[model samples]
Target: MQQLLLQMLDGTVTSLKVFVLTLIFSLPLGFIVAKGRMSRNFLLRGIVNLYIQIMRGTPLILQLIFVYFAPYYVIGFSYDRFTAVIVAFVLNYSAYFAEIYRSGLQSIEKGQYEACKVLGFSKTHTFFFIILPQVVKRILPSLGNEVVTLVKDTALAQTIGVSELFRVAQNAASRMFSTMPIFVAGVFYFIMNYIVSKMFDFFEKKLSYYR
Candidate 1:
């Protein structure tokens, strides 16, 4: 059992890496996406819309396989498995996060923009200082839900053979001919999700002052 735990722990590191890297890249990319989605240029908006549609429409496992294999199939090249997993996860979640941000962005009233203008706030200042904080508060719950889903979605990295936690558990379970390792993995996931939930709740309370 101790050895099994050590193996699982190693796998947890990989899973955690995927989770952290995806969020780091995806959150910023999602903001870019939201901006483009609301762009004045028709062509840019169309392209971003198409990307969001494709990413949100497909199953993540399929995206993982495509990301891993497309380079080899189309360009006669391929990177490492982990890179593919990260790319796929980042792109997929970025689209969802973009929509979440869009909804929050849209929810802000025109009066706020006018008020900021009267206060001599630059557009960037208005967005960053006044508009964005409120948007963050409004979107925290939806963002938290997506974040919890991301915890589970990291398992899809295994579809591209990245050996994340679920993959490690499957290997251990098959070797031992027992489901114990699998169940233990579920505990690991639950703990992660619980922590995420608590963190979001804390953030929500911190921003409750906005209301």
Candidate 2:
């Protein structure tokens, strides 16, 4: 029993690692993509929008396979499966986050920008101080949803053989020829998602002042 618990802990750690890395990379990358999609330059905005569409349109599993295998076929290079999984996850979530951000930014009243300008604020200052706070408040709920989705999406890493929770459980089940670990992994996923949802709910309540 202790040994089984230990193995489960190892699987939990793998899932946690993927989740952490995806958030670390995806959040900031998503912000950047959001800015590009909203760029003043028509060409840049169009390009970023198109890229976001492509990412949003594809299944994550397909993206994982492409990221893991495309380099080897096209450039005679191969990335580590873990690296590929993280990269693909980052790109996938960035598209979703970009849309979240764009919607938040758009939801703000036009007068806010004018007010900032009237206060002699630069565009950068206006965005950093005036615009971002409201945007953050507006999108926290949606962003929370995406983050929860991401926790579940970590299971997709198994497609690329990354040994995340589901992959680890699958391997253990194959060895033991039993479904116990698979069910155990499912429980872990549920617990993680529950924790994330609760955390987001807390943040949402804290930010209720803005609402």
Candidate 3:
């Protein structure tokens, strides 16, 4: 049991690494995608919209497989499995986040833009100072949902043969011929998601002053 716990701890570290890195990359990339989707340039908007459609419309496992294998097939080069998993995760989640951001940005009334314009605020200043705060408040719930989903989705790295927690549990289960390892893995996932939920709750309360 101690051995199993140790193995699981190692696996959890991998899972957490994937989760954290995905969030770190995807959050900023999502904002960039959102901006592109909302751009005044029709071609840029169209391209970004198409990318979002492909990402959101497809199964993430498929994306993972493609990301992992495409370089070898298309470019005759290989990527580390973990790197591919991170790439797949970031690309897939960014699309969802982009839509979330787009909705939040669109929710702000045009009058707010006008108000900022009349105050001699530059577009950059208006966005960073005036627009973004309200968008964050409005999108908090949806963003939390996506973040929670990301916790579970990290398990999908197993599909690409990255030894995340679920894969570790499966390996142990197969060797032991018992379901206990799977149950233990479930506990890990539940605890992680619980922490994520509480963190989001804290932020929601902190930002409630916006109301």
Among these predictions, the greatest TM-score belongs to 1
List model 2 lDDT by residue over 112-200, tens digit each: 99999898999999998999988988898899889888888888888878777787777888988999988988888889989998998
lDDT of 3 by residue, 75-126 (tens): 8999799999999999999999999999999999999999999999999999
Clashing pairs in 1: none
Task: Give me the candidate number with maximum lDDT.
Answer: 3
By the TM-score metric, which is better: model 1 or model 3? 1
lDDT of each: 0.95, 0.88, 0.96
Question: What is the TM-score of candidate 3?
Answer: 0.98
* Number of clashing pairs per prediction, in order: 0, 0, 0
List the candidate 2 regions with Cα displacement exceeding 4 Å: none
- Per lDDT, what order, best first? 3, 1, 2
